[model samples]
Target: MALLDLDPRAVATARRLAERAAAPVIDLARRHTTVSLERATLRLAGITGADHTHRAGDVPWVNRVVDTVRAHCGLDHGAALPVFHALAEHGLGTLTDLAEATAAGQVQYRVPTGADAARAEGSARAAIARGLRAVDRNRADRDRLVADLGDPPRRPWLYLIVATGDIDEDVVQAANAARAGADVIAVIRSTGQSLLDYVPEGATHHGFAGTYATEENFRIMRAAMDEVSREVGRYIRVTNYASGLCMSEIAVLAGLRRLDMMLNDSMYGILFRDINPVRTFVDQRFSRQIHARAGIIINTGEDNYLTTDDAVDAAHTVTVSQLLNERFAHEAGLGDHLLGLGHAFEIDPALPDSFRLELAHALLARELFPDAPLKWMPPTKHMTGDVFNGYLLNGFFNLAGALTGQSILLVGMMTEAVATPFLSDRDLALRNVRHVLDAAGGLAEDFRPAPGGLIVKRAHQVLGEAVDLLARIADDGLLNAIAEGTFGLMKRPADQGRGADGVIAKAEGYRNPATDLLDTGGDQ
Candidate 1:
């Protein structure tokens, strides 16, 4: 139920403008393939482990295979055909064998110029089918387990983060949080891991702020969470960053591990990580396709905008980004249920009508994307070190969530911005959310904003401003607007950024088995 009567025409206009703005970028994405995409292909082909040639750090086998393919055949034909052809021609028994040969500098991938494309594609499809089957098994297991057990009995599922920089410690904290009433446990990725071009192999024990997002780490966490789920008589969901340079690769891993949700956003890497806009666009498309095929809910990063830009002045930008994210998600075949569109409660508490404004914003998003599982972020931008005030602010944040019917609420800790939250801190934060949820859980069902009141007025004003911003973005191409710092007040030119070199325009016969698999509804 919409507390504020938002204008349908204005919403449609904003959507139209966003669609127009995303058109060219989407076209670019369709026409290009990135290194991450190729590497994801190798991973899907069953290449595990890493090159141990270096004493310090091991390079992933996917990297070695794709790097070899790039040097020999170029990525125009993609990594699938070349690797498949090499495997068939040399009679390599498995992908790992091929990787070993490639690492030994004894293999040269043949460019599929006049080769039997059908045979190569069939072989590639078979390999990818194996991986796709694994993903389907994970999904099936999750559904069956949830059916056998149950889900959290709440509207806004409590989301808590674990960032102990160690996988084992994260598991302990995650279990504790689950027992403490956190419905979802997000294992935050290590800082700067987003910038890495390749995912680290195997379970890691050391990190600066958070654990490395490796396939092994995901596997370990999944096991731990499964045990916790059984212990609690409810399924425990896990999440990690499927953003940054290896967006699609991480998506592949998440699918393999049956991660419940992923931090997948179109503009986040461009705005925050300085990743090339075109590169991020291409990667996000493939990543979302994987998420769609894996039945994974994708949580966008619209909340990050509030951290960098003024929450009041930049309110419309959040809506604008949400509209675009919704469109992109749809284009990638994600249903509304899988689109965990994000927003936040980051408005300054000093404002006189802050609660009303927060209500308006949250309600606006809830009304706009009624079916979407909106991931409402907690206050972080204005989180002072004062524990008492921070606790009060988190209470207000939780109140907004309960009042506006947020789907996924990331519990705000009083220690936010001051330190990595201790387990005790998370317990207190969860208690705050529990208090608000228990007290006002049913408020959204019964409450309605006063007609022409502050909330209604603010909602209309934000919608109007969003329409204006969308129009401006449509007039200037999305890429140009991004280069002009339209989103997070950070300009990332279309040409320059990390991973620019990875973007390759598709050749005539470019093939990605994953896309074809997704299109065929391969074992979802």
Candidate 2:
């Protein structure tokens, strides 16, 4: 009678997660924060480094157009998407000012819609006819540089990080990472940048551990990777966290700037950062909507749960989190391609058949979201300074990723627990991954779950347990459930944690014209 084999209890848990998300969704909508057209335009200018003084808000379409322009460009969060939408839509040669874009032009300055699929398609065809050459050109510029980027490919993706403290240093290291066979480059934000409600202006020179996640930083890194990606003859992804207070804003910025991936979790903040569960969920929904629109893949944070709990006993929790994340993303209009569901190889190696158990758990994720770019996480649980063991563990982690068919494999580093990786360390890690993958990359394909095997039985049993937990979460609120210690060995309350002030009700007078216009525009 059931639509799927998952127990009715799992359905119940999913329902509870949705219920917990409901109050926050409605509350955020009701708050209704408003920004003036002039101010929004000004903020937009700063994000893209446009030093123009144009005040065209007096025009009839000024206010309405500003709303659309600002939202598309991330004016609200003080980060501007690098797109000169006004110019692109109009085919104008310059963005000397935003006002010029809204002016009449030969190009269709107006956007197309669901009812006008043919019209949009026609317009797209025309643009491709003309601009296709340019896209190919710019893309070629990136591709040509790819060959110089050390054509090494790790079967599983390389796990990487960024330092907001210094851009030059970050760039040098990022380039080196690519040469060393890193498949992903994640620019860690300046310390506490996410906590700040407003984004900083201009190219930053100084940051703490990583460079500031500014528009310039994004552009700089994107351009850098294009060269590497082309050199390697494969796609190299750029990643940044789109969480915290400015989640929606960052997603918009990331999309417009051509960023490929983001760490955009549903309830990571409330569960870990203490962001109000209502605000986090609501913000996440809106942020993901933009990501879905921009064709950006999102990396969820379910793997963080195991860092605190017993990996063996709490394996089911990871599955539950993935299910919840998938449902939430689907509700937000994300497709399988946009899902980079997260899981880690963090179980202590000392446990019995830890490696085999990991394989079972991982393969289950691969099966669940077969079409998604599953992001297999690196080992963070026991990343002690013991570099030799850490490196071996990472090798094993890489083997799991390659075996299970994870699309976004994040390779672990031996120095994860000690410090940022040294250049030499990265080289060695790459070498390690290459050896295993070359020697045994196809190991998983040949191995099947043993008949009624311990690993298989435990995985199936854990999945059922996970479904039960999801059912409970559905009945209770996800926040209320989390407050009750539903995940991560730690218990955090919805209303009791920090960053509550950062959780603000939208001030009145905020108008999002794009939201209104796209309200009926099906997400796909």
Using lDDT, give the best candidate's number: 1
- What lDDT does each candidate get? 0.90, 0.63
Candidate 1 global TM-score: 0.98
Candidate 1 segments exceeding 4 Å error:
522-524
Residue-pair clashes per candidate, as listed?
0, 24
The TM-score measured for candidate 2 stands at: 0.74
lDDT of 1: 0.90
Candidate 1 structure quality by residue, lDDT tens digits, 95-172: 999999998898988766565666888889998989988888888888899899898987788999999889999999
